[model samples]
Target: MSDTETLNKLRGVISKLARELNTTATSEGLTPTQASVLGLIVFRGPLGLTELAQLEGLNPTMLSRVIGKLTELGLIQRDPNPADLRAIQVESTEAGRELSDRIKHHRTEAIAACLDQLPETTAQTIINALPALEALAQALRSTHN
Candidate 1:
């Protein structure tokens, strides 16, 4: 098979693997939207609801509902932006941070178990290619933007 075909097949496998991984990771703690919102807060820093809605491709009312649920759960909080009284910045709580860490740990353990099943060389190949793949992804992101 050609390298392009092999990579495409690998990408498909990775997509399925990611979905499987997220199923368990997201089951008990939060709904998918909540988890994604929490993840964005954790990694991307606090964002106003408008910004978050844009990032998540959600309508304002829908984003409001999601934020309401998260706020009610005490996993997220919003503070008025100093420069924009109408805009509220959402941030994760300490509890949310703890939950995010736990999710990370659990996913890591699961991935490690799966990787252990692979041949040593196959595993090494993936590790070695990660940087190259990430660079490619960055270039793609820039192009898309």
Candidate 2:
């Protein structure tokens, strides 16, 4: 396929995957953005609010509201940033990590089930693509800065 065609295909697949994952997030009674924020903290956390806002593509006001909701749910906590006394850092509480884990489990099971229905070769091909896909993700993230 042409490069444009390949890019289009990738976009389509990624959009579908996002939708599926968002559905899982919603099933847990959280909006997709909330789940995404929680997962980020669970994985790459103790992050400053400014940094988190950049990573999540949310403005400060919106990010604060999300943080507030998560805080109210006892899913995450904010603490004074040691480096910058005025700024705060956010990290996942135990409950947030637990919820993130459950979301991951559900997403994994759903994907695995679908993979099982695919031909062995096709399934293996998709699995083998993970490294390249991860590299692509990294490249995209870098470009976002």
- Structural similarity to truth (TM-score) of each candidate: 0.83, 0.93
Give a tens-digit lDDT track for model 1, residues 14-110: 7897687787546656776777777788777788887888777789888888899888988788999877988789899988777777777777888
Each candidate: what lDDT? 0.80, 0.93
For model 1, the superposed segments whose C-alpha errors exceed 4 Å read: 1-11
In candidate 1, how many Å is residue 119 off?
0.9
* Candidate 2 lDDT by residue in tens digits, 1-145: 4699898998999999889878888888899999999999999979999889999999999999999999999999999999998989999999999999999898888899999999999999999999999998998999999
- State candidate 1's TM-score: 0.83
lDDT of 1 at 92: 90
